[model samples]
Target: MSELKILIVDDDPVTRSMLKHTLNAHGYLTAEASDGADALAKMAAETFPIVISDWNMPNMNGLELCEQIRKHDSEGYIYTILLTSNNAMEDRVKGLRAGADDFIGKPFNKDELLERMAAGERVLNLETREALIFALAKLAESRDTDTGLHLERVQRYARFLTQELVGDPAFADEIDEEFIQLVYQTSPLHDIGKVGIPDSVLLHPGKLSKDQFKLMQSHTVIGADCLKGAIAKSPKAKFLHMAHDIARFHHEKFDGSGYPDGLVGEKIPLAARIVAIADVYDALRSRRIYKPAFSHERSCEIICGDAGSHFDPRLVAAFERVHEQFATIAERFSEPSELPGSAEPKELEMVH
Candidate 1:
């Protein structure tokens, strides 16, 4: 088992020391906080999956701490338990409403405390699902050798673009902290369907013929079907739903000129639209078998120039605002040989 760190928050030094000693004896690493405010400050500096907090504290109570933890924007879920003297049903309901995962009496038993922590561990372990998702995506990406760090670059690009739109009045209602995180997590799966493409077509050294190109375009549908099955199995998984949207519709164009299903304008999922620009930008900036990497300036010109036709104009405008950041992300992740070089703009075929 991995080292599990638990944060203990209580005003009483005796209680804190006792809990820490007990947890440490059971092979759990521990951190101490004097109160809820102190706990929040420590949490900002480090990740704590399980927090054992006393309900009464001077700076901030355990209830307020639970509420703040829910809003803290950490990457993983924090399983919080309230140590409270009040055993009333009303108090427990209040704790639940405040986001407390579990509760223990003020004089918590060693066995009961350990058992509660075990249950919290089970909940935190579910985060491994994210690791599984990324591994699966990487497996699919491994098939195409030319796209070095393509998934990483696209994930960053999609996240940066989504963050920029948070302030826009048009997307203010749609874009939020959760939506941005989901886009970052699921963007890498956009080309997962390409795994199904035949090696002959996917590994083609030169431009594909019309018939070959038609077959290549089917990757979008293929990837969507795979994710659709996953969604059916885990219908509540929001990340899979967004991944499904990106896989199915990232190739769809703004003006209904794209393949598989030519979804026009807003008909295309917003997540897919954001990913479309990210995918194309990486394609334009990365070296390919048939084309040298285009300079950042040239890539920007092509993407901005296609705003209304090939890409969403609003996203294009957002890209223009943060295009330099996009360049920085590409450079940060690119190998020395993959660095963009000056090349004349060419009428490139639709990037796979």
Candidate 2:
């Protein structure tokens, strides 16, 4: 899609015309509406990513318009800005409660309006980046038919374990709700380096030789190295930094024996450690060319037995606490070939 279109709504023709002209001069494609009702009618026929509405319009006011937009489904964020004369705290609270993103006081300068819109555009860009990241991860996973829903399952499992860790005294400082959600989004990219691997190796139906296995293991470093340049350029992008850590260290073991890096115990980044068990558990339960599907009981035993070896003991304990959630996710997002152990099999979609 090209740049998103904006909707301008106001009861006064003068105010609506001024906004339309000003935004168009700023290079924004805009559509004008006489009032909130007209704006909603236009929205029903077409999508508007941003809605700029006057606070007091007849038939349907801006507050009601904002609330209605919030209740409607949108493919992307529909940021609403209210043009209001009131600068009082109570009015601001009411506008926010009614779902407005920001309030632009009446008689506002062009610079102020443009600045607010620029901030809103930045948020929309971030959401676009996240969606593209997920799509790219899915593209990488799609190469191997056996890997159906692997990315979704691991991210969900990782999210569950990370969420549980947020309350533990050991991880309270490092794990929070935002961090858990980031793990859910970035975990899918852990194996994104597989995109660089050859079809012959990736689609093989048998075990790879030692050299091929070495080539396969390079996916970790390959993914990390690729993300390093991205992090250097963005510097402040926390998601890229976490992605780099996860892509590089997810294969590293708790004991100093696993591949790519011999990171042991607390030496491994916490996010990588959390995803390690998630990836392992999902691989064990899901059928693959190299291994038959292991029963849930056997899979759990392997994970529990490897505590302090294949995974962090604390995360293992976290896993023990949320294993049922993991099992539910596994059954819900099983391979396409496997019968969905749940009543509904779902494809994960972005929530804008």
Candidate 3:
């Protein structure tokens, strides 16, 4: 309803015109592209939430377009519906593998097309929410010297560790498909409170003095306060609530030594516990102004060393099982396939 635009991709001008007119008549905005190549070109100029593409086209085809979109686009997920004459199961399978969300057969029915579009709208709206969450976290990350890659790397690492925890006796109830997904989506904000820390403390190239260190520790509270405000406005948003927990408690240790509340053992939020492992591992591997990046082996030993004191012992076991995977994740930015489809982020872009 917010002036949603649909991109209509087809080689046939007649078909394109008809689809464009039909969408426009229903109070929707539309754009036209002659083929998959043209559609990609259009995307370079602007992003469309929904794309209705024909299966057969000159040069590149709809399937290729969907694959390309899944690979390159991260501003948000694009809901793609293939308009094809082929109704065979194999064709649908191919389209799905290429990342098409829904489909409409050729000689489209006005009613059926509308139904598919409605389904796509629902999916796109969900993606928009995820994008906004990432954008807000990026906003907070911008206040720090480290690139937003810090968030991207941590998100995957958290998700990787969390997925392996599923069904373990300790996390039998807490670790599910949904929990794993929300953690991946919301884990990046663990340091969102750093936005409130002054640069003298946050960006200090040297070791912090006792007072400076104390000031630095307050970032957990700062981030939580920001997310708590958002939660108040959207009381039913589970992700926002999870983000608040992560921002406030990720630094809390399994023992009582951690700050901002000194929650010990199971008292720390499970989301925070998971993110702490991820955040620490990333911090150790990433190069800081004061310290060079630690070797993967050294980072592993440190995390394993802190198992009972700083991290959940069960999660440390999980990390051991996935240590190689964690190292792989550090080298790139991608979430596990168990969550929604992921795209490689080019770099940290500030959320406007």
Q: Estimate each model's TM-score.
A: 0.67, 0.62, 0.63
For 1-352, candidate 2 gives per-residue lDDT tens digits of: 2355899999888888888878888788899898888998999998888899999989999999986775443556677899999789768756764667787989868889998889778656666676877898898888888877888788778866775665466876786545765787799899989988998887767667677777888989989998999998999988999999999999888997886878788889999999899998887777676555666776788789888877888889888977887877778677566542321111110000
Clashing pairs in 3: 193-223
lDDT of 3 by residue, 249-329 (tens): 998889878889999999999999999999887767765555555667777887898889888899899899888868776
- Over 4 Å off, model 1: 1-127, 350-352
| lDDT (0 to 1) per candidate | 0.85, 0.79, 0.79
Candidate 2 local accuracy as lDDT? 0.79
lDDT of 1 by residue, 237-297 (tens): 9999999999999999999999779899989999999999999999988888777788888
Model 1: how far residue 281 lies from native, Å = 0.6
TM-score of structure candidate 2: 0.62
Off by over 4 Å in 3: 1-124, 333-352
On lDDT, the leading prediction is 1
Error of 1 at 191 (Å): 0.5
- Each candidate's root-mean-square deviation in Å? 8.4, 9.5, 9.3
**Top-TM-score candidate index:** 1
